[model samples]
Each structure stands twice: as structure tokens, then as C-alpha cells.
Target chain A: MLAKRIIPCLDIKNGRTVKGINFENIRDAGDPIELASFYASQGADELVFLDIIATFENRKTLANLVKKVAHEINIPFIVGGGISSIEDVSILLNAGADKISINSYAVRNPIQIEKLAGFFGSQCIVVAIDTKYIDDDWFVYLNGGRIRLPLKAFDWAKQAESAGAGEILLTSMNHDGTKKGFAMDITMQLSKNLSIPVIASGGGGCMKDFLDVFEKAEADAALAASIFHYKEIEIPALKKYLNENNVETRL
Target chain B: MKVVIIKYNSGNVCSLANALERLGIRPILSDEPDELISADKVIFPGVGEAGNAMKYLKEKGLHLIIPELKQDVLGICLGMQLMCAHSEEGNTDCLNIFPLYVKKFVINKEDKYKIPHVGWNNIVLNNEVNSKLYLNTENNKYVYFVHSYYVEKGIFTSSETTYIIPFSASLKKDNFYAVQYHPEKSGKTGETILRNFINL
Candidate 1:
């Protein structure tokens, strides 16, 4: 049985963890590597480092960070944010990132998804969709959810799957930051329809929220940030909770 | 001890080297037959299409040297599949070190299973396995796996993991050992597995 993944996302800016971490018994709270090691020790299934610093000059910094994280952490991790070209992905993967995700770039030139997946096997390419429910339909958003596109989330995701995406990181703009729960309806719809694994991101408030997403939505993984960073919920305890609930989790 | 990881066109060799480094072993990345043949242990790591990987191996003449190496050799993911007799992926013929065939997963009408089984999955150690790879490790402990094709259970089977059906989690034959999961990315249990292989 494939265990449900519990991922803690770290937002990186200028090579430092932007979201302030509140974990104890550690040094250098802003150090991404330190936080990543802590999470891995706490039984995090995987980690995602989204380089929020979207500038060409900071590319070297992100690459160096990836190299450091890969050396210190044994678990697989994904690096994303501002990854547009094949050269960018080449730099990250060469720097030892296990996988990389692309967002607006994938929507801008969807062919790039095919080319990227073809160039580097689909197993390493993840298409992240930032979607929002608008006017009785879900539409894809871009530029960190600042710009709205006329594309339907389901249609774009289906197209992405056909274009060779190994997984989908679906984030509901409406449900995000609400701390209510994951967007169950849309997530379930996509997870049921798509053949690839769907990772439900955004509003992960409590442990039950995680269970709801996995059980109701059939999500392969659940990604959260603030709740973990602020010490609101610990990973090991959450896994234990889910295990008691009969959800298959890696402990 | 000298450890050499075969360097072909495949990816993840750098990560593998880092894992070995974590185990306090500095491995030599080389494609030359002499280095691979002379190393104390050979680690064949791969992540790519089987056809292209086979083509690169043949081009460098590693196809001949790898199978004949007498020392313990470990194959991972694509490397494991390539060590088998054949692969449905790319319809490519492998090195046949193990008399097994790699086949693509087929999920019956349920349509819930995902291809390229990603993330952590537990492995059930084969009964009375002699490899010592799973020594001191409890059964059903999870390891990281990311692949679409799997080797069928056979005489060389040492461990098994079930996704939709039972398939080879790890295979062993004489000096050749192969695992479908990524020990390099499997955290502590993975580190233990690698350490066991090094000890062997």
C-alpha cells in the first residue's frame, strides 16, 4: 500500500525561509536546511522548497540551497517557484533536487509541459495548479493568484495529465489561508478523474482537516506550512492520529 | 574501501553519492570498466528510460562489464529493471543478470491506482532471505519508491511490496542485488539498507 504523504512546505526568499519557524531545540530559525532537517526528523514524508524570490540573480542562491538540503536530508524534496525554462530545471536537478514544479509557465506555454516531461521523465515534473471557484466554475489563477485566467481547473489539469504531468499540486485560492479545510469537492472531483496522484495544498488547519482531505477527497498527499511552522500541529502526533483513524500513513 | 558508481546518462548519481557520503563512504563516479571492475563494491544507479539507458550502457561497453563483476553489485529503480531479462517499457531487452521480466502495472477497472507508484511503501521481506539487506529491519517498514514498471516475483526475489498486486521489492542473485525502491531517498531505513549492502 502506498502511504499518504505529509509534506511541510518552506517558502524561500533570498535563500532564507521566509515563513518564520517556531520549532524549538534548534539553531538558526531562518535557515532552510535546519528547518528541513527538523521536519525530516519529525517524520515528514517529503518537503517542498518554493523559492519565493523570483529573480534571475537569485538563481545561484536557490541552487546552492538545494545542494545543501540534498546533502543534509535523506528524504526526497521538490524545488519550485520561478522555474520557467529547461535551463532553470537543469540547474536545480543538477544541484540535486529530487523533483521540480512549475506553475504559470506551464499554463503560458502548455507545450513546455510536454517538452519538460519528455526531456526529463514525467516522474520528476509536477504541475502545480492554483485554482479558485468563481461564478459557478473553478478557474486557474496565475502570478501567485493575483491574476485570474479563463482556464477551467479541471480542463487544464486534464490537459496537463495528458501532457505528461506525474502529479498535480492543487491549491484552492478561496480555501487557502482560511484554515477551514482543503477544498474537498473540487479535489475529490480531480482526484477521482485524474490518473496521477493529486496533492491537496492550501487550507490545512487541523489534524482532522488532513484526514478529511485524505479520506473524503482521496488525496494522495496533504501539504501545509503555517500550522507546522508555528507549532500548531506536530507531524509525528498527526501521523499517529491518522494511523489511529485507519488512514495509511508513514510513521 | 573503494566504491565506484557507474556514471552513464542517467540522473540521481549525485544524490546517491551524497547518501554514501552520509554513510562515511566517498564513492568514485566512473564509467570506465577498470574502475568499476576493480572497486570493492559497485553501485549501479539509474533514473531514465530503459531504451536510452541500455543504449548508453552498450555504448560505454558497461553492459558487458557490469554483469561479469564478481563483487557485490547493487542496482536501483531503472538499474534494477535493466538488470532483468526484459522490460515492457521501451520494449527494451535488459542485461538478463536475473531471469525476470519487468512489466508495466495494469490496474483493473477500479481506476483509482496511480501509475509510477510514488512516495513511501512498506516491503515484506522474503521468507528465510539470505541477502542480509533487510537484517535488523522489521517487516512492513516503509521505503521510498518512484517507478512505473516493476519486476515480477521469481526465484531471485528477496522482498516484495504490494501496490495493486504483489511485485518484487528487492531481487538477489549470486553477487547481483537490485531494489525497485530508492534507498538513497528512504531516510533512516534506507540508510540502514545501504549500510547493510556496504557491509555485505
Candidate 2:
């Protein structure tokens, strides 16, 4: 049986790990490569490095950082943020990152997903969905959860699957830093509906929160930023906890 | 050493060359029998109809030279499937290096789960670890994958991945190594796996 995955997400800006609240008040966490290495050592199933600053200079920084991280790390690492085209995906993959995640751009140009999936294969493309609950419905948001799209979160997830998205990273903006736990209803519905692996992102407060999501959301993986970054929960320790709790985790 | 990447009108050879360049390994894109057998490593990569790809392989006499090569041989994506016994796609015949048949996903196309199992999937070590392929990797380590047709779990499968059904993600026999996933694009895991192949 496949063991569930626990992933730690690091936001990179100018080659450093940084995290912000609702995409603001960005504060430094540590070095991107160092932090990624640390997470892998701590038994994180995978690591995601999203270059928060996708500007020209920052993109260069990301590329350089990716080179350094790829040389040192051995686990799977996903790179995203400002990935607009297949060329961008190619550059990142060549830079030694494991998977290229596209959220905003993929939602806009769904055909590119199919093209990249055909050319590079589907496992290389991870479509990250930043969703928010508005008026009794979960809506998909882009631009780092600032702009809302017309389609609902569930619809976009299905669209992503149709577009050849390898995995779906469903993040709830509303519950994201609240620490209340993942929006299980939304993620569970998508997980139940889609055959592709669904990774639940955002809204991680404690180890219990992770258990709650895994038991309820039925996600293949869970991705958290602050909880893991701030040392609120240690990965190996959490894996042990999950294992003890009868969750199939690789400790 | 010059490597010959069999160019039988398959998928992007440019990416393969690009991955080689990243490793500072330059390979020639050639279908010539002489160049192919003489090369250090032969990579057969394709991404279309399996039957047509095998047809071209047979027409160019590559179908013969590929199996008897003493040098290391690597196959990626369709390249890997073509190295198998047969593929359900287009009802194609394969090289039969590994006596396994590729079959389509046994799931409803109408259901939410789609075909072409694409994306990152963990590689479950088949216990019979190949020293050449399964280096510095633990059991159930995730790798990238993208394919519709899969080789049913069998003896030749060195590594396996599960999607709609558990299938052989990689097969290893003697000097022949093949991966159903694109290691070129799998990021760090891809690079390490490729490097391991090169080192092997």
C-alpha cells in the first residue's frame, strides 16, 4: 500500500525562505536550500519551494537557489510561483527541481497543461489551487489568493484533471493561517471525486489538525507552511504520531 | 563518449539532449545501426502511437541492434514501453526484452478519474532492487510518472507505481533499464535517477 505523504512548503524570495500572512508581511525564515535540506532530513515526504518573488531578478535568484538546492537535496522538490509557460516549466525542471507547479497560469491557459503534460509527461505538472469560501461556496483564487476566478473550486479541480494535471494541490485561503484545520468538506469532496492524488494545503495548526485532515479530507498528502516552518510541528515526530494513530505513514 | 539517441520520429529528443548536456554528456541523435551499437549508451524515447513507433524501429533495423547491444541501454516513456514484450496501445509488438504486456487503464473514461496517469507518483521498490537503478532510494519513494498504458506487475518489474491500478513503473534486465516516467523532468529525483543511470 502507498503511504500518505507529508510535505512542507517554503516560500522563497531572493534565495531565502520567507513566509507571510495572506501573502503580506513577509518575514524571513531561513535559507532556501538549507531549509529544504532540513525538511528532507526531518523526513518530509517532499518539499515545495515557491519563489514568492517571480520578478526578473527574483526569477534569477530562484534559478540559482534551485541549482544549489538540487545539488544538495535528494528528495522530491516542487517549484512554483510565476510559472506562466512550458518554457518556464522546462527551465525549472532543468534547474534540478522535481515538479513544476502552475496555479494562476494553468487556470488561465488550460491547453498549456495538456501540452506540457504531453511533452514532459503529467507527473511534472502540479496544479496548485488556492481556494476561498465565499457566500457558501468555495471559489478558486489566483494571484496568490487575491483574485477570484469564475469557476468553483470543485469545477476547477475537475478541469485540472481534464487538462492532464498530474496532482491537485488544494489550498483553502480562508482557513490558511487560521489553524482551525483544513476545510475537510471541500477537499474530501474533491478527493472523493478525483482519481488523481489530491494534496491538501493550508490551515495546519497542529499535528491533530493534520490527522483531522487526513482522516476527514482523505487526501494523498498534506502541505503546510507556517506550522512546519515555525517549528510548531516537527516532521519526523509528526510522522511518528501519525503512525501511532494507525495512519499509514513512513516514519 | 558519444551517445546515440535513436531518432525514429519519437517524442522530443531535444529534452533528452538537454538532460545530457546538464550532466555534461553529449550524445548524437542517430538511428544508424553502426552509430547506435558503437555508442556508450543508447536511449530510445518516443511519445506517440506505440505501433507506429515500433514500425519505424523495425523498418530502420533498430529493432534488431537495440536488443543485442553490449553497451548500456536506457528507454524513457514510450521508449520504455517499446522495450517491453507488447503494448495494448495500437495493439503493438515490442522488443520483448522483458516479457510483459502493456495494458490500458481499466477504468471508466466517464468517471472523474482520467486516463493517461500523469504526474508525480511514488516508486515502490519491488524488493529485487537493481544495483544500477535503485541507488540511494528507499522503498516507496515517489518519482514522476505520465502514461496511459502500463505494464502489469510482474517479475521483470524492478520498481512499481500505483494509480488506477498498480503497474510496473520501471523494469530492469541485465544492461537494459527503462522508466515509464520522464526522469528528465522529474526535478531533483529525475536528476539523481539519471545520474545513477549514467554512473551505472
Pick the lDDT winner: 1
List, residue by residue over B41-125, the lDDT tens digit for candidate 2: 8887766668878899889988888999888888898898888888998888899988888898878756545555654567877
Q: After superposition, how far is residue B65 of candidate 1 from its true place, in Å?
A: 0.8
Task: Give residue B77's lDDT in candidate 1 (0 to 100).
Answer: 94
Pairs with backbone N, CA or C atoms under 3 Å apart (clashes), candidate 2: A97-B187, A98-B187, A122-B119, A123-B119, A123-B120, B122-B142
Candidate 2 chain A lDDT trough over 10 residues, lowest sum: A67-76
- For B44-134, candidate 1 gives per-residue lDDT tens digits of 8888899999999999999999889999999999999999999999999999999899999998667689898999999999875567888
Report the lDDT tens digits of candidate 1 across residue range A1-251: 88999999988888777653222122222778889999999999999998765799888889998999999998988999999899999999989888899999999999999998888889889999989999999999988777899899999999999999989999898877668999999899999999999999888899999999999999999998878877899999999999999999998
TM-score of chain B of each: 0.97, 0.94
* Candidate 2 DockQ vs. native: 0.20
Candidate 2 deviation (Cα RMSD): 4.5
CAPRI class of candidate 1: high
